[model samples]
Target: MPLLRARPALLYAAVSLACPEGALADEREEVRTVLFGSLDAGRSTFVSAGAKVAPGGIGRDGFVTLATLGYGLRPERDWWGDPRGKAGLTPPRTLRHTVQAGAVAGWQWVRDWGVAALFAGPEIAFEVLDSPGTRKLPTPRIGARVQGELWARPTETTLLTTTLIAGTARWSAWGRVSWGIRVPEWSAAYLGPEAALYADRTGYRKWSLGLHATDFAIARLSFRVSAGWVYEEQIRRPGAYGTLTAWLPL
Candidate 1:
C-alpha cells in the first residue's frame, strides 16, 4: 500500500492535535511507526521512525513547524499490477517486488482543538516484475510523493482525522478518514470507525472499512491500531486487513 507515508507525521498529529495549546500531550516528540496488514497476494509491512524538532527552540506562542528526518522501509512482494496495454494486449496481473526509501518534511499548524499539515518528499523505488513463467518487465526506479492532513476535535472527547497521499512511483495513492470518541478511563484514548481507499498505476483499487483506536500508551511507548474488511476491485471480493502503529521518542 503506497501511502503518503504521512503516518510518520500522522503519528505526530495524533499527539499534537489532542494536546492543549503550547503543550504536548506526551513528552515523547518522535515518530516510530509499524504499519502491517494482510494482502491476498501476500503480506504487507512498513516501518518508520523519526523525531520532530523545531530549530533553535519553540516559541512562547507555541506555533511551530517541525521537520522530520529518518528511515522508512516499504517492501512490496507478490503484489500484482494491471496490464500495461488495452484490448487485452498486455500482460495481466503481473506480480512484482518494489523497494522504497524516502524522507518527509512538513509544517504543522497546531491548535488546541486540531492540527493541519502538509508534507512532501522524494521516494526512490526499485521495482522488478519477475514471475516464474512470465516475461520480465521494466519499471521506473524513483518517484516523488506529497500528502496533506487535517485532524480535528469536534467535541472535548471526539476525534476526526483525515489524510491523503499520492506518488509518481507505481502511480499510487491513498486516503483515509476516521472518527473516534475519547475514553477518559483508557488513557484518554479514542475509538471509532474508519474508511480507507487506495489505488495504483496497475489499476488496483480497494475500499476498506474498519475500527480504529488511538493513544494506548504503556510506559514510554504509545500505540494505534486499525482492523477491518477490504473489498478489492481487482479481485471482486472481500478480505481481512489489520494495521498497527507505534511511536517512540527520538
Candidate 2:
C-alpha cells in the first residue's frame, strides 16, 4: 500500500510533475511516457499511463517555449466495504470501476530551475458501480478540462511542485503540492513532505499528508514514491496510503 496511494484518477488528467531530467534533454523529437499507480489503506487503487511528445535538447539561455501533444488512459477502483476484515466476517466490498480518456495540447516554459506548464482538453469517463451498498448507476459524461503545473528549485537543495486541475471528468478538480529537500549525494532526487485535497459531486472528498521521494533515477526511468496518512470524509476512518510514479523517455 502507498503512503500516498490516494492519487485519485482525476489527477491523472494528470502527470503534472515534469522533472527536467526526463523532458527529452537530448534535442531530438521524443515521447516521455509516464506510468503511475497509487493505493490507500489496502483499499482503493489508481493506475494511469500517459505520454508527452516534445523535442529533445532544448534551451541554451535556460528558457524555452514548447508544446507537447499529450493523452492518457486511466483506470481506477475504490473498494467501499469491509474494514481490514476481522474474525470470519468476509463481506463483499462495494467497488467502483472508472475509466477516463482525454487529450491535451500541453504548453510549457522551462527556465533555469523553474518550470510552468498548462494543458487543456476534452475528457470522457465511463463508470461501473459494484456497490452492494448502493444499487445505483450514473450516466456517462464528458467535459473540457484544464490543468496547470508549477515546479521550482527555490534553492540548490530544495524543490517545490504544485498542480491544479479544474473543469469536468470525474476529477480534473483537485490540487496537490509537494516540497522536497535534495538528498545528500543524489543530485536528481529529493525527499520531502506532500499534501493534497480532492472533492467531487459524488460527495467524495478527502485530504492527505505524506512523505515522498521524487525523481529517483534507475537507468532510463525516473521515479517518485510516497507513503502517508489519509483522512476521507466518506470513509469511516483515516487510512494508510502510498503511490509510485515513473517516467520513461523514448
TM-score top scorer:
2
lDDT tens digits, residue span 1-250, model 2: 1111111111122354334243323422233333433333334565666565443322221212222222222222233434434445444535566666667656666555666668777777777766544556777688877878777767766777898877587754778999887675664567899998877666776788999887666786666788898776656578888777765544
lDDT of 1 by residue, 1-250 (tens): 1111112223356222222121243322332322221122212333333344443222111223322222222223223343334345534443345565545565666555556767777766665655544466566457787877788767666778898877786588888899988766766678899998888876767788999877666665667777888776756667777767665443
TM-score of 1: 0.69
- Candidate with best lDDT: 2
Runs in model 1 lying further than 4 Å from the true structure: 1-11, 14-94, 133-140
* Model 2 lDDT-worst window of ten: 1-10
Scored by Cα lDDT, where does model 2 land? 0.57
